[model samples]
Target: MKKIIFIFLLALSFGCSESDSASNDSTGQGGSLAVFALKDNYLYSVDHMKLNVFSLINGEKPVKVNDIPIGFDIETLFAYGDNLFIGSRNGMFIYSISNPENPTKLSSVQHFTACDPVIANSTHSFVTLNSNTTCGNNTNVLQVYDTKDLKNPKLIHSRNLMQPKGIGFYTAKYLLVCDDVLKIFNIENPSEPILVHAIDKNCFDVIIRDNTLFAIGDKGVYRYKMNPNDIKDIQLESETNF
Candidate 1:
């Protein structure tokens, strides 16, 4: 499940700011799958059984403000504006973070039991459920949901995937990591994702910033130059194995 989190910290860190500087952003959950997300001066994280909230108001010492009992097997954490999206093996939990330190539960959408991670843009939220994990299920699927209403999340589209893993958005483009294959899609039309390219490579999680793609896998890290026009035209600039 640690392999399910990946997103650009530069984008997530500026939760309340309009600045686009990379240095201002930092990832609390540094794994492929993020279990921690920072918003404004508050940080929210989930362990196997609880949602932990921290306050960075003091800046000198991050204080534990709250710990909400959620459920078992919490896999991923993502923050969008005033909403916090939590993905567990059994469902997606939505929360309203209008009061950054105190998050209120909004709703929960249940799904087939599997290892799931989530990412979202302005209009839609994307979730990938993978089989062949400790979760004990063989259902691989990608779910697209309408996020216009934060309190009530409606599923707009569902497609069977091939061991889908970490997912992220590069503007209107969607990056999906499935096994060793990286798939790109243009999601201007949220309900219908148009396939842009499929690159054969070892990828578990990815972060795109400054027109460059950073993919991490068991082997190591790979750097690629992103070509929005033609994903095939994207060049692999460097590779470092750990």
Candidate 2:
């Protein structure tokens, strides 16, 4: 877990530079368990029950601008476009960041209590519910929602997995899901995701940058070179065990 966090922070710092800070509009990606996200010149974060907003306009010094009460057990934070998708033990919360300093709650969808981590794009939202941990319930499944209507998101599909954790988009059409192994799905049809490939690695989370894929699991941190043309052509680039 420590190694995963380290790699996530490293990735967050990689593309950011002096010019990025000067522009004050840098954005970064995080793994499934990430609690913070950057959008425009503002930094958004969530704790177990609160959503905090900080101003990065000063670059070096972050000013706490606002604090709003979110739901309980917030576990993950994902920023897409002008919206913030928050995953809590109970459900998923959607907030609009159109007003950078003050985010407005748009909508929320409840689910069974479990370890939830969520990610989203313009059309859909993906959430993984894991009951293997102490979060509660006996449900382990991936839930896909049609998010065209931000005010009312409907569950479009649900697929059971052994112990699904992190999820990411390898491309616009391909999605990477971490279960007992690393599963890659072709999401041509957002409602129905077809599993195309599975790597025999016990990954807990994954991060994709360009054509490079970084997966962290029980064994170690593994890096793979992705083939856009063929998913089967993905090759192992390196591995580092902690």
Candidate 3:
């Protein structure tokens, strides 16, 4: 019932013009486990092997626009500007949504088999590979790729992590990754992220909006107030246990 309500709210939220919506909100920039993302008047979703595009121009009724075959084991979707970042067991696929009704494949970055979740901006893309999952091997790490050349993403740096899941930017300089705990990193230099802080709560995913963060874990959903001035001054706001 709660899930239904959440989806319904998202539907209404995306009904408005793109200029009226906050692009960094949970409905726009989702967690790594997100299968669907809202961009402008369209919603892009993925199944195991396909990318589905839906037009929300009518607001009340969503019209399926296109269904393009992506690779298998497609697990997550993230949208930045006019591009869509897809995470699969095998690689990260970048697609151009400049044509909302007809998205075109741009390029792909192949990686080892793993449970992958990805996020990106114009400068760089971040991917977390969890080895504990069925899709992963023995490699568990966070990789940073220089996306200056979107067609050929070059891996610039990598750091070993526990079982990292969803990732998001708290600020342009701060990044949040979920693992054994809520780990925060200073991405002042996009290529070399330095670990800054870690919250004790075990989280699986996180949704960041401005200074507010919503973290999801096995036990429940937790919210925190992020201080933009102080990287280590995150304060718990609320929690909803399952």
CA lDDT scores, all candidates in order? 0.73, 0.85, 0.82
Q: Flag regions of model 2 displaced more than 4 Å.
A: 1-4, 13-25
- lDDT tens string, model 3, 60-107? 998998999998999989888889999998999999988988989989
lDDT of 3: 0.82
Q: After superposition, how far is residue 10 of candidate 2 from its true place, in Å?
A: 5.0
Residue-level lDDT of model 2, residues 1-242, one tens digit each, is 68665665556534542122122345665776778888868888899899999998999998999999997898898888788999999999999999988899999999999999998877999999999667899889999999999999999999999889999887788889999889999998988899999998888888877788888877688999988899989899999886
Candidate 3 segments exceeding 4 Å error:
1-27
Cα error, residue 200 of model 3, in Å, equals: 0.6
Query: Which candidate gets the maximum TM-score versus the true structure?
Result: 2
Best candidate per lDDT, number?
2
What's the best-to-worst order under TM-score?
2, 3, 1
Query: What is the RMSD, in Å, between candidate 3 and the native fold over all Cα?
Result: 3.1
Clash totals, every prediction:
4, 0, 0
By TM-score, is 1 or 2 better? 2
